[model samples]
Target: MKHLSDNEKDTSRIAAALAEDLQPGNVLLLHGTLGMGKTVFARALIRALTGRPDIDVPSPTFTLVQTYDGLICPIYHYDLYRIEHPEEIFELGWDDALADGITIVEWPDRLGSYKPRLSLDITLSNADNDPNKREILIETNA
Candidate 1:
């Protein structure tokens, strides 16, 4: 799927719509450069999954990962930016999250070869050099 988001609100709206179809064991890999709307999309998805529009969904940049209780199941948000190696994910509950949880990963390239095969990939990029406009592409390997 492809979409053009005019602003942050538009990006969040798109994420919320996608969140409606998420389920446990689902893995979402977000790809984007710094300053892109990856975190905005992630936060929107988390809020939608938890059924709490106003919930705090902070970026897990420092913590590496954050957990939240979702209406359908647990939500695992991972930021692999700080990870030195993909193997480091094992020490951060990567297995447990994959067993039963909706995992949203940012900077997934940092995962190296540890990336799951069956997962959804979302890529966000500036559209035509317009910082406020984002081109989002979503694909699934399911």
Candidate 2:
């Protein structure tokens, strides 16, 4: 699937749609460069899943992982950008999240060989030289 986000609100809308369809054990790999709207999409998604517009979904960049409960299933949002090795995933409760919730990963390249075999990967990039407009491509392995 392909989408164009003309503005931040459009990003939230796309995130809402995806969040609604996500289920336990589902993994979403988000790929984008810095300032390319990955966190914006993720924060909106977490809020939609919890049915709370004010949910404090902070970027897990430094902490590496952040989780939110109280939804149909939990959501584990991970920022593997800081990880120096794939084994760090295990230390972050990777196995538990895989079994019980949705995992949304940022900078998933760090996962190396441990990346999920089946996942929905989303790529966001600046479109038409417009910083606010994002071209998004979605690929799925079902």
Worst 10 residues of 2 by lDDT: 67-76
lDDT of 2 by residue, 1-142 (tens): 9999999999989999988788899999999999898899999889999899998888998999999894888889999989999999999989988998889899999999999999999999999998799998989987
Tens digit of lDDT per residue, candidate 1, span 7-116?
99999999999998999999999999997989999999999999999999999999999999999999999999988989999999899899999999999999999999
Tell me each candidate's TM-score.
0.98, 0.97
Report the CA-based lDDT of candidate 2 relative to the real structure.
Answer: 0.92
Which regions of candidate 1 fall more than 4 Å away from where they truly are?
none
Q: lDDT (CA) for every model shown? A: 0.95, 0.92
TM-score quality measure for candidate 1: 0.98
Looking at candidate 1, the ten consecutive residues that score lowest on lDDT are: 123-132
lDDT of 1 at 51: 96
